[model samples]
Target: MTLEIVVHRPSVSGGGRRVTVGGVDFGLARGDGDLVEFLRRAGLDDADQLVSGDSPIIQWRGGRAHEYGAAGG
Candidate 1:
């Protein structure tokens, strides 16, 4: 299983590269380690369960879809 990390930068006001995980949106200033830690804390490190077709536990929060688990795990 492989984890895909996508970095997005918007060309608009208040637009910047951010990492969203488990319904939480974090700025790039937070650092990569922080992002990884956030994912780990969200039970996303379980590669077995993630790759078993039960991945991307999705939940609606703040009018957006927050996905958990590994991508293509």
Candidate 2:
């Protein structure tokens, strides 16, 4: 089964992007580290690689990888 991971736009408050797996909300991630943990918990052992590189499994919305601009930005 393909995991539909979506990194939503960063929030204006804390600049944390919401992460969802297969349409399930995994909470907000402030950075790649938070995203990696969420992915690992979701059973993706290669979470590190997946979060680091450009992988189609992850559909980033609003912003690209690691581009969570400052809340003031």
Maximum-TM-score candidate: 2
Would you estimate the TM-scores of all the predictions?
0.30, 0.87
Per-residue alpha-carbon lDDT of model 1 for 1-73, expressed as tens digits? 4444333333233322355554365444133344445456545775344333435542222222223222222
What is the clash count of model 2? 0
lDDT of 1: 0.39
Residue-by-residue lDDT tens digits, candidate 2, 37-59: 99998999999999888788898
Model 1 misplacement above 4 A: 1-6, 10-16, 22-29, 46-73
Give the winner by lDDT: 2
Question: Candidate 1 has which clashing residue pairs, if any?
Answer: none
lDDT of each: 0.39, 0.86
Error of model 1, residue 42, in angstroms = 2.4
What stretches of model 2 exceed 4 Å from their correct place?
70-72
